[model samples]
Target: MSCQRGQYVTAAVVTAGAISGAYYAYRWYQENATKIPEQWTQVGTLKDIYAYPVKSCGPVIMNKAELSILGLKDGWLRDRFLMVVDEKNNFVTARAYPEMLLVHPSVKSSVLTLKHADMEPVHVNLAEVVTNQCAKTARVWGVEVPVFDCGHETSEWISRILDKSSNNFRLVYYASHGARTLRAGTSKIYRFTKNDTGALPDEVPFNLVNQASVDDLNTRLKETQVTPRNFRPNFVMKGGKAYDEDNWKFVKIGDNVFEIIKPCFRCILTTIDPETGVRNVNADPLETLKTYRQSTEPAARRSAGSSPRMGVQMSLRSAPGGLVKLDDPIYVA
Candidate 1:
């Protein structure tokens, strides 16, 4: 009877160990499974390239851009290389002042010209001030980044256009910094490699959107039409299904390659009109987007209240540069 009891106890222990091992193996699979795309397909053609020299301001449409991990090199400089901040060095964006959308920027011969409806155009020579020795720290997404102040003349000029009581808003340019460490609060999914670098962008160096996604959103709307400008994507592509960008792991445009890092989370800024800077009051697209496009991924969702994704953020995989042109075939790799 004692020998028989020992055999029974030994069998039970083996069974319990087998069950525990199986459970942990399944858990490990679930955690790492999302890293690669389940399917890859030829999606579209690169339709446009838009660069915003000043963050949250108008875009300068382009026919081509030199793709780089640092940012889109358009000869003049990189996108979001310059920014507008308040007196306290807090980043000022279209979310706070819808009028910011009215400020249009164009670059030619290394000169950045700012044009608005109600004010005279202001021009800043990029080559002249890009190397200014003085630097001050500014905040973007709670990150204290050092930037070169464009001087009081530029500040006064921007203030006049916005009709501010004081010249509190200043235009500052990024001087150079080594590889920026992603903040602790940032999602691990968007974490950068040791070689990754960044400028003054909200997150990634490039934002790409699909024209089909915009068309799909327009079909659901009965009130107004929204353009690619409202979303402020650096690269706009066409020919793919709406939201096809979400499934892309590796993509090639022209001769350059990029890694689709994350889906962009829509915010209240999308509700503001890109032309007039007036926000939609009756049927905001964000409100409608929340109905169908809400993401299950915590990192993909901007906040508990925001809607689904409209675009994707990407980083260059092929570097030091290659020219990506309009109508270039985009392939999933």
Candidate 2:
């Protein structure tokens, strides 16, 4: 009986020690998870900054901009804060109507101006849209988002430019106070918190492209050369080896810090020319990327299928309101 008691006590002590060790290990990881490493590698330099005030439309290039949780911002211009929707409130993009890519959106003072080569420039009073327009819900990528209609005048303007016969389209601005719930499949892959959903962006708030990578891809093209604009990245970096961004978990530019969330999977959109609004006949770059850039992990392969990995999607890790500027050194940890 005495021998049995000794064995029982020894087993109990062993189990207790294991539990204590696990507790301390978890505590250590929790404390260190968010801490930036002391040593970081200088990966590249910020070459350009882009803010797409309207989704699938032209970008507003800036030398310096404030980083917000939603995305890059100036006084009245925020990234992907305005989107075009059909009469049914379904989101529209350049994918269906390639001419949408040619619409240039710019903001000055309290007005938003939209210019297209084929049509006259139209202006919308942004302040009036916010103060007077009624809030309504619009569907985008299977998510419902709160938005304000910019009235029939702007709607008619956009509709005439895209499709002259049908007055079935409308211009909508994001209601700044509301958030859209991410689709279950997207949330599974991105692991975004409630606060991470930003306006009408396709996914995350920030997208970064390495210029070296685009150059490398151009080398593989037989008849076509692609540029960073094809990828629609918010931040463009240079001076790094091609595809070095694949390994970066976190990056810092100026005083702004961003956590790399996932590899941006390329799609048919990359095949479209941002300048001409025409798709490549051969789909050379995307086809070329398929040969080499497919994700190796089985789970990632299942999630992304045949899409090739290009830039990295990111979220602001440091507090918002930090400024990122042209030529800022990009440090990766």
Q: After TM-score superposition, what is the CA distance of residue 329 in candidate 1 from its true location, in Å? A: 0.5
TM-score of each: 0.83, 0.88
At residue 257, give the lDDT of candidate 2: 79
lDDT by residue (tens digit), candidate 2, 210-284: 999999998889999888999999999999999999888888997677878789998888888999999999986
Please write out the lDDT profile of model 1 over residues 1-333, one tens digit for every residue. 121110101334445434543453344334323343334466899998988889888888888887644578676656888888888998889898888888988888768888888778888876556443366788888778777777777799887766564597899887553334565566666645533435777777888889999999999988988988888998888998998777777777876677777777888999999989899995478887888888887655544346668898777665445798899988875
Pick out the ten consecutive residues of candidate 1 with the lowest summed lDDT.
Answer: 1-10
- Top candidate on TM-score is 2
- Model 2 Cα shift for residue 102 (angstroms): 0.4
Give me the displacement of residue 319 in model 1, in angstroms.
1.8
Please report the TM-score between candidate 2 and the true structure: 0.88
Give stretches of model 2 more than 4 Å off: 1-33, 187-189
Worst 10 residues of 2 by lDDT: 1-10
